[model samples]
Target: MKRTFHHSLPAFITIIFALCAVILAGNAISLYNNLLSLRNTNSWIEHSWDVKDRLKNVNVLIMDAESSLRGYYLSGNKTYLGPWLTAQKKIEPEFKAMAELLKDNPVQSKNLVELKALFDKKIQLMKEGLAAFNDGGLEQIVMLAKTGEGRSTMDEIRLQVVVMESEENALLAARSGRFYQRYQIAVAVGMAINIMALLVLVLFYQLIARSFFKRLAAEGELKASNEHLEARVLARTEQLSILSRHLINVSEQEKAKLARELHDELGSNLTVLAMDISMVTEKLRPTEPELAERLQRASATIKTTIGLKRRIIENLRPSVLDTMGLAASLMEQASEFEKISSLQVNTDISDEFDKIDPSSAIALFRVAQEALTNIAKYAQATQVWISLRAADQGLRLLIADDGIGITAEALKKSKSHGVIGMRERMLLLGGNLTVTAAANGRGTVIDAYLPFNPAAQADASVAG
Candidate 1:
């Protein structure tokens, strides 16, 4: 049976698509969260920058006022007062901006309030001292400006402002760091999501391909199994036919055995008993010379009957085969055939003989006997060679006769039951028998090869 790939493909594709969709959805959620975190970080960074810039402006105003006061005291310069006044005008706006920028923080708001009060007090004191100086009280003005009390108040106020600015800068740095970390995290998460998505896609593709391949493999296996089953069924049918033929052959052999026993053993004994009775009757006759002649005829008749009986028994089953094993039995049969038929027979047998099952030994002996009989009766052969050898792989039996060789057409057309029986017996014992014309048209040859190792039967079982 041919198989198709489309049978399970749709289901596999659908499952892969579902898995990929799930992975894509998960990655999208991760990316969205990362983006939100990054946006919040950017907003915090922008606000921190604004606060830092306002703080810088406030610091510049305070520095300008301090420089003006120092110049006025050092050289008693009235022109420095002009710059001081301009700085004073700018200080309020800078302070207000700082206050507004830090309004969200309680500590910074309190520090701004204290700074404002300190600034106002310093400005008022400077203005009053300036007025004193203009009215010719310069010494007192200088004295007041340089006093520890005024310096202490200014120091406290500057320290408070510095603390507040420092706090604000620290907060700004922290927020900047946080913002940078969030941005980096967002980028990392996005990359991770992208990588995961790619991995999922690859997995999905592999799963789909694997599923298709598995289906194809399964279908191929099923087809091969079916083909194997059909071949086995056909082989079994052939074996059954061969078995039927074997049963018929066995029945015919049994019948032949029974007929030979009846004709040889019992018939020969009865004939001998009758011959003895006839000799006695002749010996009792009135004429003594006639009795001698009749007795001599009876004795000759008894001898001929006994000889016929022995030949019949031998034909049915050879006693040598029962006692001497396959090799000796074959040699004895060949000698008897040559003596009886006036045919030249030659034999070559290996001394390395081993015991085999009685049935197998008998079958091989019968096959040899039949081959020799056929050659003697029909081949009109003058010379025959029989060889029995133990080869490396198995035992081999060869019988060749110098006779009128059979043509290929005759070999094909002839329905020779003797050869067929020989082949069947060899096949039953896990062996093979082959018949071919000898080289140069010298004779007809028969070869029987049988394995010595019975383990070869296991191979036949496994194949079946």
Candidate 2:
């Protein structure tokens, strides 16, 4: 259950985070749309106000023209013409502006057109009344006013202005309502987004807290289990290490003993048997040819057996290793490998370790020996380089092969006991061994470092 939750927790967190991101993004887009709509509504409201103001101005100007014309007819004063001419000049642009404004609304546009026609008629009547006063005095003006055409036209213009104002008022109300709606929606979206953010944060925090508490509860148990397992593993490894070291010592002793016995007993016996067979063959050869031939065959067989025994002794414990030291033994091994494997063996042997520790010496030799054997069997190389040298008050033996490089995966999967045995030998002697790719990246290099002071076995600090 714990493992399943641990595996599933990341997916859960990812989904929550994705949801939060989407919510925030959606809120932003909604807010932008609301603001845009609100701005458009506001502009429309201002436009309605402008159109209503222009319509009122048109009505007021037409009224001013009619009033001025009546005052001028009554007083025959040129000063009354000032406001009449101003109204006449102003109402045209005013009507033009209103027409431009109402062009989008068919109903308001028709009303504005009627209003313009009425204002034009009122101006024409005003002009005619002035002309009548100039031509026939007060009687002509009275005659024009009595017909009541000017009064009716003025009334129609007022009515048209009222109609357009009513339309603008209705449009303004609708736009204002829509703006309020968009504003409320924007406010609600903002609040919802904020609330969602708070909830997400609270949920995330609670999840983290719960997970932390659960992990804290299990931490002690996990630590105890790990400690117990590690203690057992450490104890088992120590025992195995002791057994391995003892076994290697015992094996070396047994091999040395067997080699001595073979040399002393079997070698002497075989030499005596060969000597007796040779003497009998010469003596009894002419007397009995068949017997002599049997004697010669037996002598040859005995000689072959002696040679085999000698080789076995040499392999068990090389005499040069005991007498000439590590370097000579390693070179002999290298020279022998070169002959047997038909591969190039370049040597850089040092005489610095002539009086080295026997245990250390054998460990180094075994590492080289094992590595060279692996190279012959597995490396399929054409050339090998062997180096035994002193480095940082310790012995460093390096062997490299220009063969297919070793891979980390191959090392992990390899089950070669020679590698294990060589490692164990070095660990027993406070030394370290490493196998790596060659510097040129096309081969394998083996490095073995044995510290003179066994306690100072830091891996690479004093190693070459």
Candidate 3:
């Protein structure tokens, strides 16, 4: 069994491991997909940030150009002219950079190109007006500046740049939303996998534990059953031995009673008759005066014979037991024992004896007899108590003595088959017997409990 369990354990563990492997494989696939999605999302974000940075630089250049134009219009300083020319040179390259960055987006690229063309026209007009001012044509320059054509051009360029920036912002928003959605999906899938794995592991663990406990319980039950069977067999063998010994004892007792009757009763009677005949012959032969004394001796011998015969009959089978039932017989026996042994005997017999079967009555009486006899011989007891009563589902008999108690070692030895015999009888009758030290460790108490079916007894009564 141990080897079988060991082999089966590995198989069970392997089954659990296989389940975990499947779960891990599924999670790994999800992880791979999530990684791919994340990488794509990161690339999109980096492209959007680069476009936004280029747009920022373009807006800065437009601001510097506008500031320089306003300065030149107010003071017409050549120092402001340097900044305006530098801003002018920067515009084309910045617009071209913005256009290239938005090449993947047609709408944003078109807007960038339109803004660049508008800014170029505005720069050409400003250059023509500045060349006129440098050649002493101040009136034309004033006319161009006052008509606000430069401001109108700046406005159109700004509107196109704003349109291009709006397109880039929309692209960034869309990519961000996709990235967030993918991240949430990955997280949800991972959580689901983990939860499923945990549930499976928990269920498998419970199954294994339940299986282990079930096997353990079966093993324990088998062990207990074997022990119980062995005990029952030993008890049966001991009971047969005790029965054989009891039968022998009963036969010897009967023979002893018969021999005593023959010797004490019939032998005495014949001896007295022979003596009377001898006395008569002597008296007749010599006319003896002692014939009267001899006749009285014969009469006394006849009385002794009658008493011996009565005793023998009582010993063979007490009439008191048949007439008054078990309780009275037990009381009489106890009284006789007390008288013979000079020990005090106390008894409490319930009036429910009529409720007991005759067989059960006999068994209980014999058990009491044996127990008390043992007490008389070995207990050195000053007092003994016997009780009989009805209990739930059974009748109970208690025999206790205030004497030297039985030792634990003595109880274990089973050398005295007397107690074992009593226990076996009770067990065969579907009853139980217990022997324990009396209260206060003063002596020993023996209790026997026997159950009977009142209905069965009633049926027997009707049959009888």
Candidate 4:
């Protein structure tokens, strides 16, 4: 069955988190913009109030100056002129402050300029009234005031204040409306995002729960399968071990039978031939001397043939391994190898080696024979050292040579049956075989170890 959230689950989860983050970021931006809008609205409301205050101050100062000028003209007292002078100085500054407050609005700023010009004309008219009253009498001042320039200027200033204040109020309303809308949008988006996030979290937890249960079920099945497989492997290994033992026993029995045939059947025939020739030689000696000499040579040749057959039988199945023991068989084999190969063969056999089981002794003897054979064929050594000892509750056989060392490739080659057979023999005896370069970077060393007792009889195991 296909898995529910198979390979793409992680990617799906990552995309969900990314969407949540984006929602949160968008909501945060909305809230920030709303906050800025509210701040701007508040600033514009404050500005409107400031512009009104400046306009009110300007009107009050103009009225005060007009009243002071009239009083000064009526009583002809310079003390009444002090308020007029003070109002003249203050009104211009008030107008300047109002212009600065409304500078962002071009229409309001332009209105302020017109208002300033009108104030200047009103101030000039008031000053002219005072100067006329001082230079002549109240008549010129009355004449100037009757022209209604002061009233016209006050009216124009009132109109400009109303216009600028109206513009400011409109701006405040618009900004407030935008702020409210932005706040509503932010709140709506935030609530929607929070609901989406809750749903995503629920789905994530569901996926995790499902995955956990699936893993738990899979683990149970895997453990059961492993136990079954292990049982099968153990059964197969036991069968192989039994089969190997049977084959080795059968091979050994055949070898012993062949050796017996060669020793008895072939050896008897050659002995009979030698006896007949010797008898003929004695009879021919009385008749023909040359014929008798030829018979003697034939008899000698038959003896040599019988000796060769005996040696071949002994090599096939050495009787010394059973009668004289493992140490004697190894030493005899080494001496024979030396004779055949004309290479020096050194032997060192510990007395404890003879105390091992007969089967173990036989396996070790065969391994030694195989090692010497390989050395004779491949080592090209001038001298070989063969040693047997008892150590670690087992027997160790070490055969070392001084010649060209064995290469890794040669050791791993499939055709190296001599080395493989030696190893199999040791394994059948519940032992191990290791071949390596000699200690002094010289030729090969074949080290074999067998338990003091052979495990079981197995002919194929011995040669596998």
**Model 1 root-mean-square deviation:** 57.1
Q: Per-residue lDDT of 103-175 in model 3, one digit per residue for the tens?
A: 8888877777777778778778777777766676556667777989887887887777677767777887898
lDDT digits (tens) for residues 1-464 of candidate 4: 87665665588778888987887887688778877877887787888888877877887888888888776765467787787889877887787788678778898888888878878887887777777877878667667668887677778877876886687778778877877887787788888887887777677888768878999999999999999999999999988877876786677778889999877766886788788888889998989989999889878877888878778877778888767777888888888889989999888987545546656776787788887778878778999999998778688899999988799998899998888888877887688999999878999889998775443324423632
lDDT of 2 by residue, 1-464 (tens): 45533545587688888988988898879878987887898789889989988887877787787788776875577888888899988998998898888888898888888878888888888888888899999889878878989888878877877888888898888878878887887889888887887778677787769878889989988999999999999999999889988899898889889999989977997899899999999999999999999999989989999988987887788788888888999989989889889999999998656567667776787788789889998997999999998887788999999999888878776685776677778888778788899989988998888878543333322442
From the highest lDDT down, the ranking of the candidates is 2, 4, 3, 1
lDDT: the better of candidates 2 and 4: 2
Clashes of 3: 0
For model 1, residues 1-464, the per-residue Cα lDDT tens digits are 99866655577668767877876786678668767766776676676667666656655665677677666764466777666878778888887777777788898788788878887877776667666666765567667767766677668766876787687778767876876787677678768766766666576677768878999999999999999999999999889868865785685478468756766656766586767767676766756767766777766766676676666666666666656667887888888888988988999976454255555666677779889878977787899999999766678899999998666676556587788888877877678998899987778999998776565435433543
Instruction: Give the runs in model 2 whose Cα sits over 4 Å from its true position.
Output: 1-236, 453-464
Worst 10 residues of 1 by lDDT: 455-464
Best-to-worst ranking by TM-score: 4, 2, 1, 3
Q: Name the weakest run of 10 consecutive residues (lDDT summed) in model 3.
A: 1-10
Error of 4 at 344 (Å): 0.8
TM-score of 3: 0.39
- Measured with C-alpha atoms, the lDDT of residue 203 in candidate 1 is 61
Note the residue pairs that clash in candidate 2. Answer: none
TM-score of each: 0.44, 0.47, 0.39, 0.49
